[model samples]
Target: MTSGKKTEKYKLILDAAVKVFAAHGFHKAQVSKIAKEAGVADGTIYLYFKNKEDILICLFKEKLGELVEKFHLSIEQTTNAKDALRRVCEIHYGELEAQVDLAFVTQIELRQSSLELRKEIGKAVKPYIVLIEQLLLQGMEEKLFRQDLDVKLVRQLLFGGLDEVVTSWLIAGRKYSLSAQIEGTINFYLNGIKA
Candidate 1:
């Protein structure tokens, strides 16, 4: 196969793997199942990934890399730190809403992987956290956020809160719109945490 065809095939397998992993947790999800989902021979997956764990890692990197780039570009267009943060929250929640299955794969099924896999996920997660930290620092510099606040702690809080909110929505069967709470949630964070 040409390099372009090979790359397309790899993405097809990865997309199918995401669906399969989301439907069946990692332990129960089989390579054959992913292969069937991808409409490729079971051996084809081996060509792109060493194993299932490799697929999970690639999924995280691809998804999270896109997310970080979007956040950076979105923030660049805004001057106010709070506005930028709100945009970030909006984008994050919007993504979860738009891609519910992928969100399930990410927020829930991904946690079932091994500790080593979790460590790899942590490395992929750093860029997203850094985006939040940069916003917090900007807010602090502008006296919009509490000057005494630890940037790392603030980053954790922002990410943790948003993550929990999304998880809750997913757990609740997505009965309500995740993006609907953006204003109140942003206000709560800003009022309580800002300087």
Candidate 2:
């Protein structure tokens, strides 16, 4: 198990990797570049992570893990299923907006990874998928969503829609408020979900 300081170093490395990866793209971003960005030796990077791919997976686990946690916590504060869904989107876009480098790393750099790397990335993303699945289940339970709807498919739709919108925002240089779309996105989701 990693100690507190070790964990800190790990996070520092991931943070640096985001900037390095975003600036250089995944293939062009070397472990040495990331280590330099993190102010650690390239060998030190291997001590904490096996390779560059490990760093990328670690980064996604760190960021997306936080998103899932925050989404769950925020949902706990609300009773209305629709409100819970909206809260999740708000947190999603707000977190991305709060870190442009991370936004670029996730939205742009991540896509440039290889198919195997992409599969690894998807495995790291299970938490977010399961969270959305639970929320859809809850919405159905509360009679706020269509009972006949497939929770899994609906989850794909919701996550896919939000993901595409954010991708568009990132691609467009974020000229508009990403969080500002919360209401409209929620409305679109509810129109499909509402019983």
CA RMSD, predictions in order: 1.3, 1.4
Q: Write the per-residue lDDT of candidate 1 for residues 1-195, one digit (tens) a residue.
A: 899999899889888988898888777899999999999999999989998888889888988898888988998899889999999999999988998878998889766778899999889998999888988988989999998997888789989999889899999999999999798789988997788
Give one digit per residue, the lDDT tens place, for model 2 in 1-195: 459978888888999999998888888899999889899888989989999899999899889988888998899999888888899899988999888888888888768889998899998788898888888888888898899988888999999898888899998989999999999998999998898
TM-score of each: 0.95, 0.96
Error of 1 at 164 (Å): 0.6
With a 3 Å backbone cut-off (N, CA, C), the pairs that clash in candidate 1 are 145-195, 146-195
Give lDDT: candidate 2, residue 175.
96
- Minimum summed lDDT over a 10-residue window in model 2 is located at 1-10
Worst 10-residue lDDT window for candidate 1 reads 105-114
Instruction: Please give the distance, in angstroms, between residue 187's alpha carbon in candidate 2 and its true position after superposition.
Output: 0.5
* Candidate 2 local Cα displacement, residue 192, angstroms: 1.1
Off by over 4 Å in 2: none
RMSD of 2: 1.4
Off by over 4 Å in 1: none
